[model samples]
Every structure is written in C-alpha cells, then in structure tokens.
Target: MDAANLEFIIQMLEQDTDLKEKIKDQVTEFDKKTRTMAGLLNKIHSTPTAQLPPLLDSVQPILASCTDITAVIAQLVPANQFWRWKDMWCNSLRSAVFSATLIEYLRSGTLLTLPQVGGILGIHPEWADRFTLAAEDYLHGLISLVNELSRLAVNSVTLGNYEEPLRISAFVKDLFAGFAMLNLKNDLLRRRYDSLKYDIKKIEEVVYDVSLRKLAPTPAK
Candidate 1:
C-alpha cells in the first residue's frame, strides 16, 4: 500500500486502541464495585430474614456507583459500535446484573427481568442500536442466582430457618420450569441450566430434612 494510506490506517488503529483502553479502565472500576456489592449480598446466607432489608439497603450506594461506571462506559463507546466493544465489559456487566438481580430477589423473592437489570445498570434495554444488556448476560445472571439460592437454602437450615428452604425449593423449581421452555443453544447456558437440577436437588434435600425432623411448620388444613 502507499505510504499515505498506511499512515491513515495506523492512525485509525491507534485511535481504536486508545478508546479501548479508556473503556477497559471504566470496566475495571465497574467490576470492582460489582465485587463489593456481591460480597455484601453474600451475607444474606448467614443473616436472618428479618435483618436482611437493612443489609440490602447498605449496598445501594455501591450499586449506584456501578451504575455510574456503566454510564461512563456507554458514553465512551461510540454509537453503533457497542457490539465491537462489548467483549471488554460484558463479563463485568454480567456480574453487575447478577448483583442487582440477587439484591432484588433477596428483597422481594422475585426475579428481575432483563429490562429491569438494564435499568439498574443505567442502560437502555429496548434499543437494539445502542448499548444494552444482552439476553445471554441476563440469563447468566439468573443462573448465578439459582446457584446462590441453593447455598442460601442449606445455610438457612443450619441457622434453623427451616421455612426458608421450603420457600427456596419452590421458587427455584418454578424458575427451572420457566427455563425448560426456552431452546437454549449456548453451550455455557446449557451447562448452567444442567447444573440447576443439582441445585434443585440440594434444596429438596434441605426441605426433606426439615420435614423429616419436624422443623418446618405443618400446613393448616
């Protein structure tokens, strides 16, 4: 190629590299905040259900900080180039989604929809032409939620919160049923989905032990 053409191409590559570095810095900050939130949320397994609201509330500021980082990332990435730069931030985004979903579920016992997850991250979920949380990432977060809930189930029983295990068993089974309807083609998703059965089993075992030991409350007939 001509010298002028080579110079132009080199400049374009250097600009792209500089942009990627900036985005990566924001993503690193985002990941750090997400890890902090996750660590705080992990206390739920040991915390009493009555004391959970305040625990969940304490992480709100960190979550808001994560949202701000995501907003900065959105601005740094050029329009129509979200997919090209997504790999740099997708993992951190997925962890952020998991933290948000877990906090919501711990607060209300319901799953956060993909749109809600996007909202928590300060991104647009409806726009296909701009930065948004990918469906795969949301699903990955749900898979993580299931795994965490299973651990919570076992821990709850240890804390003598027998009813919590029963509740978790029902919720996880319902979630697994919903997942069964989707034709998941992603290998990671499929593997994660397969692992849900094990989680269900762990929860069921907890429920069974509670029932056998007469720890869970009997139904009022």
Candidate 2:
C-alpha cells in the first residue's frame, strides 16, 4: 500500500468519530440521570433516619432509567473500550449505590455487600450470560458513601443520636479496611481511597466524643 493510503486507514480506525460522538451523547444523558439522583439522595442526608426509606421512592423511577442507559452504553461501546466508556457512568453508578446504601444504612444501620449493590443497579453479579456491568464500579460508589456517612456520624451526634455515630464509625472503618484489600489500579479510585482516611478520623473523633461523654446509648446496665 502507498504511504498516504496506509496513514489514512490508520486515522480512520483511530478516529472512529461517529462511535465517539454516540458514546458522548449517551454519557450526557447518564450525567443528567446522575445529577437527578444526586439531588434526590441529597434529601436523604438531611432527612431523619426514620423517614429515609420513603424518600427512596422518588429515586426508583430514575434508577430504572439509569439501568436502561447502562444497557445501551454496554451495547454501543466496543469491548476494547468498554471500561473507558463505563467510567463515564461512575457518578450515576455511585449515586445508585449511595441511594441503596443510604436506605440500608438509615433503615438497618448497615452497609450492603457488593452483590446487594448490584441489585440496586439492576444487574446480576453472577457473571452469567447477561451481566452487563462490573461490581467494582458500584463498589466505588460506596466509597463516596463512606465520605457522606462520616459527616452523618458527626451530624448524628448533633441530632441526639449517639448510637448512629457509633455505627457510622464502625462502618467507615470497615470500608476503609476493604478499600485497602483491593490492589486498585485506577489512579482516580486510589486518590479517593486516600480521602477515606480523613473520613475515618472524623468518625473516630465523633465516636470518641460520644463514648467519652457516656452519651452513647448502652444497653441498660
């Protein structure tokens, strides 16, 4: 082949401009869905824990929409570029994770396992025939929740709930430990992992104050 002809072929393959724009358009929709969810879940932060689950009602419809968008994105991007385009939905994925975790946290004062997180994202983790996304993306979302829960731990103490802060401290500690177990290769995820330390410290401080004050509600002794 002539030099100019070979170079043109390389540029055509490399550009894949149509596919890039298609991915971009879908990602824009994903971003909107994420912001919508983030806004809805934001209400959860201020909401009394008792009333939290009901607030999840508003997010249910959007979760369905986000799930559909995820499936479409999976089909649009080639396998080679899957993870790259998938990264675009991390915010939405995390928001879904946050919503589920927050609902679980407020309702039961516990964190959901990654499989459970998959349930929130409407995908199966069994690696079966139809699994469209990875559990790792949703797990990253939980990291964001750890940050949210740290503030909640402090706020819980302010709200006259010593027990919740104690729970938050324990939960954040566990999440911190879990993040440490993974040999995370993603630079952005690793950086976020670094921030967990500060959240851990914040929760610890709250726990310490709660215990020191003897304000932490203990079973009748």
Candidate 3:
C-alpha cells in the first residue's frame, strides 16, 4: 500500500463514526457476557469438588440458554456463498479466545502486558510479536472474500458468451447496475473489519502499558 492509498484508507476508516459505535457496541456486549461467564467459572472452581456436580447441573441449562452460538453465526453470515462464512467462523473463534483471555485478565488481575500477546495467541516470541498479525489474518480473509465476490459478479456478466463484446458490455453494465447495491454494504463491512482490527491493537497496547506500569519495581528510598 502506497502512502497515499494508506492515508485514504485511514481517512475512510475514520469517517464512519456510526459504524465504529456499532463495533464498540458489539465488543461491549461480548465483553459483558464473557465477564459473566468468567465469574461463574471462578465460582465453580471455588466450590468443593463434591458439591460441583450439583452446582454445574443447575448452571448447565442457564448457560445453554444464555447464548445460542449457532443462531449467532447464522445471523452473521451473508446469504452469498462467495462471502466466505468459513473465515468468519475462524475469526469468531479467535475473537472468542481473546474475549476469554480478557475475562481471565479481569478475574485474576494478572499483568498481561505487551510482549505477551504472542504467548496468549500461542505464537512463539521468535515468530512474531503482536496482535496485529491476528488482525492481518482477518483483513486478508475479508479482502479475499470481497475479491472473490467481485470475480463472481464479473463472471455472471460474461457467462455462456464469446466473441460478442457488444452483448457482454450491455449485460455487464446491467449486472453492475444491480451490483451497485453492494457498494454500501461493501463499504460498511470493510469499515467494520478495519475498525475492529484497529480496536484490537488499541486493546493490546492499553493492556500492555497498564501491565508494565503495574509490574515496574519500586523506587529506592
């Protein structure tokens, strides 16, 4: 990405305040639920082994009712097959892991500083050292999906035709005309992905800074 392109993309990202709010809302909702789950799990751990069975029995139904994973996934996937639901599922799992990690951080008050995301994400220190890699994976997946959808759209315009540029041009124009509706959806989806990845970076930075400050040695008298 050239500097100009990068700058433009950054500006585009900043322009969508409402989308950022929605992303924040989504993260907040997930965080709240994860915290609740963490507290419950902590309580479960604190309970005696002998008493655990009955306690878990009572909690199982409630936990199951709290959120329907399948339903949520269904709601997230677009109807089009080219949109890559599999990548969404993969990223969702990663997000869940991050959420769980955050919940653990809150419950234990452990200093999960920077230089530690690699370990959290199961990446060795020698390999790579930031949450941005995870975000890159997400962005690449979404970009591939969008490119595939664009290709599919192009293919639909040229289907079963040869040596007829005029006919293809007319049909392609019509196809694009219909595809115009996707413009806003594409912008929104891209913005959401970018904002989310950016937010992940911010979270990592904040946690790291806080952890380091907390872990710093006391000053000499």
Candidate 4:
C-alpha cells in the first residue's frame, strides 16, 4: 500500500501491542494474588473445621484486592473488545472464582452464586456486555472446587474429622445435581462435569466408611 497507509497500520499495531502488554502485566499481578489465596485456602484440608472461619477470613483482603486489578484491566480493554483479550485474564479470573467459591463453601457450606463470585472478584457476572465473568469460566471454577473437595474429603478422614467428610459429600452431591441440569456445550466443561460423578463417589465412599465404623456422629432424630 501507500507509505501513509503503511505507517498508519504500523502505529495501530504498536498501540495494540502496548495495550496487550499492559493487560498482561495486570493479569500477572492478578494471578499472583489468586495463587496466594489458593495457598491459604489449601490449608482447609489439614485445618480443623472449627478453625476454618479464621483461615477463610484471612483471605478476604487478598480477594478484595483482585477487584482493583480487574478494574484496571477492564479499563485497558477497549469497549466491545472484551472477548478479543479475554484469554489474557480468563484463566486467572477462573482461578480467582474458584478461590472465592471454595472460601464461601468452607465458611458457610453453601455454593457461591455467579453474582456472588462476581461481587467477590469485582466484575460483572454474565449479564454485562463487557468485562463479565463468562459462564464457562464460572463452570470451570466450580469443577475445580469439586476436585479440591474430593481431596479434602479424604484428608478430613485422616484428620479424624469424619463429620466434615459427610458435609462435603452432601455439598458435592448437591453441586453435581445442579450441574446435571445444564446443557453444557463446551467440551472441556462437559468433560469436567462428567468427572463430578467420580468426586461424588469418592466422597460417598468416605462417608460410608465413616458411618460403617461409627466414627461419624449419629444424626439427631
């Protein structure tokens, strides 16, 4: 093309590159915070259930910081171009969602809704036209939570927290039931959903063993 056209194209490419670099830097920071939260949450497997509230509470500041980074990334993204650059932060966002969901579950034994997770991460949840948490990412985080809970089930038994395994079993089965209602089109999400059955089975086996041995406390009639 003409010299002016070629120069304009070059400038546009440079701007895009600059924007991408900035987004990547913010995403790196976000990922670091997410990993820190994950590490703290991992303690749940070894921690007594009575002490879990403090551990869950300690991660609140770290989780809250994610909102600020997300806002900066949202600003860097051009309007209507969220999908174009989503790959830069989608995985990190999903990891953050997992941490939030896991913390909520540990704290209250309830699943965090999409809006709740969005609130925790300081982003829109599936409704906003821009900078929203994709449904696929949210589903992926839930699957990760299932996997972690399975591990926690096994560890709870080791820690002599037999009741915790039963609680995890019930919670995971409820989650599996919820997932079964979705007509998931994403192959990865579908596969992960399929794996939920195995987690449920692992947790059930833990519960069964505890019940059979009378290690778990008997429920009040």
- Winning candidate number (lDDT): 4
Off by over 4 Å in 3: 1-16, 65-221
Question: Tens digits of per-residue lDDT for model 4 on 1-221?
Answer: 99999999999999999998999899899989999999999898789878888998899999999999988887788888878888888899889989989988887899998888888788854425558888889989999999999999999888878898888887888888888899987687898899888888888888889999999897676
Off by over 4 Å in 2: 1-15, 124-132, 219-221
Ordered list by lDDT, greatest first: 4, 1, 2, 3
User: What is the C-alpha lDDT profile of model 2 across 120-189, one tens digit per residue?
Assistant: 6666443233234465666677887888888788777766777888778777787778779889876877
lDDT of 1: 0.85
Estimated TM-score per prediction?
Answer: 0.94, 0.79, 0.27, 0.94
lDDT of candidate model 3 versus the reference: 0.38
Winner of 2 and 4 under lDDT = 4
Q: How many residue pairs clash in each candidate?
A: 0, 0, 0, 0
Tens-digit lDDT string for candidate 3 (29-130): 545554454456445324543454565455344334324442333334334431333443344334444433333332342323333433433433332221
lDDT of 2 at 154: 78
